[model samples]
Target: MSSFLIICKSIHLGNTLKIANEMAKILECKVLEPEKVEAEDIEEAEVIGLGSGIYYGRHHTSIFKLLDKYSFKGKRVFVFYTSAFRKVKFLNGCEDKLLNKLRKHGAEIIGVFQCRGESRLLGGVCKGRPDERDLARAREFAEKLKKKFS
Candidate 1:
């Protein structure tokens, strides 16, 4: 079986981590914080998922830093995130930022996953999100990716 690794930075309500955990369970892989990941861990994985909670309309700065610090050249990479808003237009723009970063690092983009997350900003929005329904979808996404790539 192809090995899978997820590098994620989940803060706040741990919303992104919940989604990451679901995906990891389906992939039967380990989830590591960006800070905890080593170069060898990245080197050993056949598939790597870069995940984080959206902040200020983009991925966490630590995630961006990981992209800057490592070489993902020719690596199979997937992107995932949790955001308060799920609008197509807004999401496309948000994903574009991370996509551009991955391209610059030479990662071979494989898939993308995203979902709504509860946020306390602006009198709280999307509360109780990334709920069971979101987790089920995340698992299904991982299963499909595993089938296609593994």
Candidate 2:
């Protein structure tokens, strides 16, 4: 079986995990929650997926820290995020920033995917997200990942 790893960190309802787990199943990948691993321990995978909960329009601390410690050279990397706002263009910056970072580390960026995650704060603007539609979109992205990296 091909081995892939998904590193996810979240501050809220674990939406990142939910989506990453679903994608992992599709790719037959291993689940590596960064919070539970040493920085060096996460380097064995050939392909890496980073999923994060967008905090203040950026990735959470745990993910940022892991990115700082690990280099992505010669690896296939994909980024997925759940955001509070539905502004399609607003997420472009975040995705670009992540892509830039990965590229700097010599990673082959497969793609960037985003979905609306549940937001209980601020009057529920992003409420009821990672719903069926979001899951379908994520799964589609996962299929693309399989084709590219498999």
Candidate 3:
């Protein structure tokens, strides 16, 4: 089984990390915090998974910095993000940016997995409730990713 390195970073909540952990367990991938991993560490893994909590329509700074510092040459990279907005347009072009960055370093971009969670603010989707269905969908997404990449 080829090993993978999963890194999750968030600003307010760690839902993305939790989901990534679950997927790592099933995929037999090694999970690490973005702050604890170095650029060289990423080079050793066949796959790299990045997860983050969306804030103000963007990923955390730590996640961006990790992507900026590392070269994902010849690696399979997956992206997962948790957002409250059902339709977030600001993030529309981010996947392209990430893919371009990874490709510049000779990496293969596998695709993205996203899901909706509870909204913290006064006005948003399911403000006080996180639908069980949403998490289940996240799990399903992980399963599909495992089957495809593993």
Residues 6-30, candidate 2, lDDT per residue (tens digit)?
8888667877777888898898877
Where is model 3 poorest over a 10-residue stretch in terms of lDDT?
Answer: 122-131
Model 1: lowest-lDDT 10 consecutive positions: 86-95
lDDT of 3 by residue, 10-51 (tens): 554556766776777766777787889987779778778887
lDDT of 1: 0.90
C-alpha TM-score for every candidate: 0.95, 0.87, 0.81
The best candidate by lDDT is 1
lDDT: worst 10-residue window of model 2: 87-96
lDDT of 1 by residue, 34-79 (tens): 9998999988998999999888888899988998888888888999
Looking at candidate 2, what is the lDDT of residue 146? 84
By descending TM-score, how would the candidates be arranged? Answer: 1, 2, 3
Task: Tell me the deviation in Å of residue 104 in model 3.
Answer: 2.8
Assess each prediction's global lDDT (C-alpha) against the native. 0.90, 0.77, 0.70
Error of 2 at 50 (Å): 0.4
